[model samples]
Target chain A: MAEQDEDSLIGYDPLAWMHRSDFNQDSRKAEVGESEVDSSTELASSTETASNLEIDLDQAPADASEPYASQGERAVLVLEPVLNIQNVSVLHQHLMQMLSNFEAIDIDASGVTMIDTANLQLLLILKQTAIGLQKSISIDFPSDKFIEASELLGIAEMLEVDQAASGFF
Target chain B: MSARIVAVLNQKGGVGKTTTSVNLTHALAKLGKKITVIDFDPQSHLAVSLGSVDPQKSGIDKVLLEGVSLAEQSIPVRKNLNLVVAGPRLQEIEQLTDGGARRGDLLRRALLDGNRDEDFIFIDCPPSSGVLVANALFAADEILVPMTSDYLALQGLSHLVGTIKKFESALKRPYKFSLVMSRYIPTRRISKEVLSVIQKYFPGQILATAIRETALLAECPSFGKTIFEYRPGCRSARDFMALAEDFLQGRMM
Candidate 1:
């Protein structure tokens, strides 16, 4: 019985409701003969409208072309098991300092078991800063928690989450 | 017969929306009725009260957000009782500004096929008149309002009735509206006055069994147990059984 039920859901798309509006917008854009809209630009527009975010990206060091870690040349930051509201501020401050010194930072998020909007916003700010400074920011071994949260907010593409990195594939 | 969908709603916070949903649904299920309780509230308090603490669990949020089969997301919590925890990112629905009328009707559409086998489907709604509550209102035929005996509660009740009435007028159908007196303190004169006031306006609408306030009732959720599981043979358990019985008899309209 369970197998039958599972089979019934073979082609079901859970996020279809979220895309209905986007589909309409896309069709309207197509009707007007507009160029294909870049999803990253659309994500940036959505983020710009989010007045609730506390992260001020304007103050981020724009010219981050040098590596700052005095501890080591290959600065790999291992994330904690839980990156939620409780530690978002400290993580934000740490990422901000890292962005100022490191031209490229590798974040090991394999241990993140819990994540929320605050932490996701903090990471997005770091990503946007890297893009502006022409620096590189890569998330390695993204945990299911991080991926689910980013996808839930419709920011997985913006976060550049490689779902294949989960190794469940 | 298909399940009678009920939305356990009260715009006022701390009025026992979770308590009534968890206990009343459990009581009914214990009485041999097939029941499904959806933790429609983004806070997911009903799921937590039932001992499913993992917020990552895909639940009614998956049903509403992703259109997943409700049956697929249901977690069997008790005999004849299935629970669907509010999945992660449910709060994002409240922040949504798009979808127009489609967003409000998501729950109603999601339950179309999955609730056919259940005898009762209860949705524990959030404590605010937002899109989530609107979805609950749209999906449910009955509105089970758990009210407390106090002036502020009375004020909140009036606003909730107005919201329900607006929906009824818009849909051109009256809901099977019922009120459950929660956190009752019979020793207090104010309780009697408040009950009398509610009775004067909504006579025969309040259930006869008043769930008196108790610390044990409050403590059960912390242990992830319902009243029946927490204190199987206690006063609160008896009160909830009576409330379930009253509900079964259709004593309140």
Candidate 2:
């Protein structure tokens, strides 16, 4: 099966998405935030708030929920394969736990073969908050599906952008 | 006090537009030109090439659309090179429908008001002609078209020129531009023939520097560095240096 997968990628260039370089018509009017600058101040506060939470990665939740595993200052938060709004709350909870309990974050995303903007937005905010708190955030053992979703969303940086896998087809 | 806005443009993909944008910015900075490269392409390869942007950071698109200042969006890549990354929010440009004329002037307004000290601004355009490219064409003082020696890529010139002409006619002014022959395979006979063909069509418009195809271009991006910082001894460096000098001297060669 692995052999078949590898063979299928022959002549399949991974960085080929770099070529879809087209500007859309009337894109200048994109609607969203009205602030001229990014919401850095809000993101900073949100990050700090997340860090200040007393939730422990290894601590058992009040209900039957996922647990975070700690590895010496770096707490690991593995994500589920699908990360839409339906599952975003659980991921968000674990994310908060990791942020609050650890000085550094090592996210294991091998199981996160799928993701959505809310999850990515959460990660983006978490990374920003980690930066403000002088904490480190890195993706541990990123899966192919994880990398693809990140690239599709143009948030590869959130994955810490796997260099070796950057061109994976 | 004024930065000369140059849009590195071409409608074709994989022809080294991002490579040229990042390296040329590096080369100009080496020659003491205060420069900023706006990764206008939503793919954000310019940021990847130079390792300039943080994954969580929003790009210049925020400035262009949301009223963010250049100072807020710009990241210092080196001594004189500042970079404005293209964030995922920029992908929103494809579907935008509200602001029209204000949007057209957003980049020009940003460059005019926000960036007064830089000597040059390089906008790395995407491969397809769209609203983003239109904005770039409207804002740029000059356009640099990077094309491979392949014939299919050559077919894009008419469309590109036509687009630019439309911009010029609408804006009631001309946008100066040049052709950059990228990924040139020196040993390939087609490369030389295409070079002559381009020269024949637009005399004295092609930059003298021809970027040779090399593994270094692909390798540097993986390391999140420019050709200058990654493998300075490579020919890619030499080509960009020559291109920069030629640019400064008007590539009088």
**Cα shift from native, residue B158, model 2 (Å):** 1.7
What DockQ does every candidate get?
Answer: 0.01, 0.01
- Tell me the whole-model lDDT of each prediction, alpha carbons only: 0.72, 0.67
What TM value does the first chain of each candidate achieve? 0.55, 0.53
Question: Which 10-residue window in model 1 chain B sums to the lowest lDDT?
Answer: B162-171
Q: Across residues B46-116, which tens digit of lDDT does each residue of candidate 2 receive?
A: 89788754666798878877888888888898879999998878877744434545545667777778535
- The TM-score leader among the candidates is 1
Candidate No. with top lDDT:
1
Interface RMSD of each: 21.6, 16.0
Provide the RMSD of all predictions against the true structure, rounded to 1 decimal.
19.2, 19.4
Worst ten-residue run, lDDT, model 1 chain A? A50-59
